[model samples]
Target: MRYFIHLAYDGTAYSGWQVQPGVPTVQEALNTALSNVLRQSVRTQGSGRTDAGVHASHQVAHFEADFPPEMTLDLLRYRLNRALPPDVQVFRIHEVDERANARFSAEARTYEYFVRLRPDPFRRDQALYLDRGRPDVGAMNVAASYLVGQFDFTAFSKVKGAETHYICCLYEAGWHETAEGLVFRIRANRFVRGMVRLVVGTLLDVGRGKLTPLEFQQVLHRQQRIAASGAAPAKGLYLSRVEYPAGIVPAADVREPA
Candidate 1:
């Protein structure tokens, strides 16, 4: 049977979501823990890859397992959590159709980057501290508006040979001031490597008066990586959500008895 695992992880201790050689990674840990609990080799495909030190609030992965009819998803979820490390967690599991892929089936993804104007020792690892001066929130929003439609994002992506097309349909893009900090949220049908971080960094530049909103739009049209600002720190970015079509998996309220 095929199962979809709902999970979240603190990226501080691991290299990234994907498996890497000779290093700790979220995928490696989850694979090992699932294998240990199932007593068989288990490999999973995540919805997407997050760079080192990037966190995820709601990520999904799918794996196939052949289990006795007596076994249940609740038992599997409980066992997987117990075997996994404290930083990595499996919250729920649902049996899905064989054709429901965790990555390719996703409809949209949302990401947020957090920034704090005041220095806070507690949030050093979760948010970026910008003490230079307050950025013009209005201008940043204006710049973000320019990114709300489809365009070539080569200026923001980090990988070169891996992508065949640079076009992405950005559904929403904007920044807002929260009580705790400044937050930038963007939703898109897809993203390229390092896309969100670079977008945030460049928007910060607009806030700081380094780049005008018009200049930012020009950068997008140029389709050159060097035309954009450097990517923001990985620690400040989070994969906040992933959306799929209705009926792709069982409803959240549906659960097997524990």
Candidate 2:
């Protein structure tokens, strides 16, 4: 049976989400645990890759297991969790169709970069403390508005594979401020490598008055990475959610049991 696993993890102390040759990775750890539990080699495909030190609140992956017809979702989740590392947790599992793919089938993916003006021990790893002078939230929002809609995001991504184009549809992009910090929310049909980090960095520059909002639009139009903002640290970025088509998988399979 093919099982879809919904999980979340603190990406500290690991290379990234994809399996690497020697360095530890979330996919490697998951494949190891699943392989151990099933007593056979198992591989998984993640919804998307998150960089080192990134975090995910809702990441998805699918794996195949050939078991005696007696396997239950509960049993698989239990065994996988028991064998997996503490930093990564499998929240739930659902039996999915053999044709389902965690990444290709995704409709939308959302990410957030959290920046706090003050230090908080509880959120140190999960958030970035950017006390580099209070930024102008209004200016940041204005610049973020330019990020909405389809555009050549070549200026944002770092690693551009031949198969992956830098053109992505930005469904929603904005910044919100709270008492403690600011959050940059971005939802897109797809993302290019280092897209979010670079966007955050440019927005920060806008807030700091280093870049004007109109100039930010010009940067997007320039279609050059060197023309735009800095890529922020990976720690502040989180894969907040992923959207899939209805009936692709049962809703119960998308999250962990309370």
Candidate 3:
């Protein structure tokens, strides 16, 4: 049977979501935990890749397994958590259509980057601390506003990325203040490798008055990777949400932006 897992992980300890020959990874950890509980080898395909040190509050993966007699999903979740590393967790597991895929079936994905104004010991690993004068959130929002709608985001993507094309349809992108700090949230149909970090870096430049909002737009339209600023630190980024079609997941499982 095919099953979908709703999981989250602190990527601080992982090389990335995918497995590597010698490095530890979230996929390897999850596969091992599942195999141990099921008494057979099990593998999962995740919604997408997250670079090293990038966290995920909501991630989905699909795996095929022959659930043994008397096996319950709740029990399986409990056991998987026990077997998995402390930083990784399985929140929900449900049967999925045999054809449903965690990655290909996804309709949209949302990511958030957190910036803390002051140093906080507890969140040192999870946020970017800006020691300089506060950035102009108003200017940043103006720059971010340009991100909504379909565009070729080659400027924000990795130069050597494996994606065939750089076109993406963004539904929203904006920055707002939060209790923890300031956050930038962006939702898009899909994102190329390293896109969010690169975009965040450029937006921060705009916020700091290093680039005008129009210049930011021009950089994106220029389509030259060199025209953009460096990628922001991965520690501040999170794969906050993923949404799928109704046929792939129950209606309650899918989300709409506020």
Give the Cα lDDT of each candidate: 0.89, 0.86, 0.93
Among these predictions, the greatest lDDT belongs to 3
Best model number under TM-score: 3
Least well predicted 10-residue stretch by lDDT in candidate 1: 249-258
For model 3, the local distance difference test gives 0.93
**Each prediction's TM-score versus the true structure:** 0.95, 0.94, 0.97
lDDT of 1 by residue, 113-207 (tens): 88999999988988899989889999999999999989999999895737888899999999888888798999999999999999999999999
The per-residue C-alpha lDDT of model 1 at residue 227 equals 96
Tens-digit lDDT track of model 2 for 12-79 = 88899998898989999999998888888899999999988898888999888897577677887888
C-alpha lDDT (0 to 100) for residue 224 of candidate 1: 93
* Stretch of 10 with least lDDT, candidate 2: 249-258
Sorted on lDDT, best first, the list reads 3, 1, 2
Clashing pairs in 2: none
Q: Using TM-score as the measure, name the better of candidate 1 and candidate 3.
A: 3
Q: Where is the poorest 10-residue window by lDDT in model 3?
A: 249-258
**Displacement of the residue 102 alpha carbon in candidate 2, Å:** 0.4
